[model samples]
Target: MTRIIAAVATAALLLTSTSAFAQAAFPTRPNTLQGQAACAGYTVDNYKERFAANSGGPDVQLHSLCAGAYNYYWMYLNAIRKGFSESDCNVTYDAFDKAARVVTNFWAETH
Candidate 1:
């Protein structure tokens, strides 16, 4: 009985440690557009609402990846507004264009 209890305790400890490690690893921001947008708290709904408000049109529909790319572009604009160098924000434009192209291509294919 004691041996069984020790084994169970060991298993629980291992699981707890692994879960902690995974949680720590999960939220790391990679040096990429999607990663940056996620770190900045951008979400699909936020993107949709902002796009509609800015365009004076209906809500824009986007896949999660596409929305994230757009959010990254928005982040670049925000950075510019906050006095960041345009050159520093230029990389995000490429990322946004790539994502937008993918979405546009998919739409073209579908319709």
Candidate 2:
């Protein structure tokens, strides 16, 4: 009975530790600007592609352009948040550039 209790306690502790580690790994919010910008840029790229394929009208295009601009601005904001130096921001810019390239590549392949 004692051995059984010890094993159960050990399993419980292991489970609790694993849960804590998982929570720590998850972000509470957008803490890094560059990461957030990369996510937003990817989202904008998807929107642009959809708009290109099935544009509603000028209004839709205008909205898509504005959204892309917003994500581009967010990239700079994220770079600042991440304490990126002017030169280091090239990394952040590269993320945005890569997102655009990915979308363009998909478009080229599809249409």
Candidate 3:
């Protein structure tokens, strides 16, 4: 009985330690544009709404990532506002997608 209890306690301790290590190892700030990617299928108003949604929350890491995505939306909106062209928005969106992929790869490697 004592051996079993000790084994369980050791397992719990290792689990907690590993979980804490993982949380600490994660980057506090986004390392790639992909981490901030959002608003892909959104219209101008929808994009704005999404940005507003991201404006506040409990998670600081989430807020930072959302801020990056909001910046991407702003670029899309700016192109539209300036009457640049659809291609301009497409370019910005493409960049956002690429950045997101980079971030995804980064996390994959870290894990």
Candidate 4:
């Protein structure tokens, strides 16, 4: 019984630690979140809203990756004005911004 409790406790600790670390790895920017909400909205929520909104899987994953990438632009520009370059922020935004556009265009064309 003691061993089982210890194992469960260890698992819980590991889960909590990993979860915190995962969230920590994710970028943080209220502005970014706001921007994503805006861009994602198809005037109210995103392209998926009109046809199908996949909250997960490849397309949805792509959407998330792109959203995060797009937000980097605002985050970096703000950080820069505050005196930090935030080079990492720059790449994701620029690349993803264009990709989002292309993806949208592609969808518009195909559908």
Q: Point to the candidate with the largest TM-score.
A: 1
Candidate 2: list runs displaced more than 4 Å: 1-73, 77-84
Tens-digit lDDT string for candidate 4 (33-58): 33433245532134334224555555
TM-score of each: 0.43, 0.31, 0.36, 0.31
For each candidate, what is the lDDT?
0.44, 0.40, 0.42, 0.41
**Candidate 1 versus the native: TM-score?**
0.43
RMSD in order of candidates: 16.3, 16.5, 19.7, 13.6
Best by lDDT: 1
Tell me which of candidates 2 and 3 scores higher on TM-score: 3
- Residue 85: error of model 4 in Å? 6.3
lDDT of 3 by residue, 1-59 (tens): 34433433443344344322111222123223432333233333454565466566543
Clash number for model 1?
Answer: 0
Writing each residue's lDDT as its tens digit, candidate 1 over 14-93 gives 43443221112112123343434222334434766544444433323434445545665565454444443344344444
lDDT for model 3 comes to: 0.42
lDDT of 3 at 86: 50
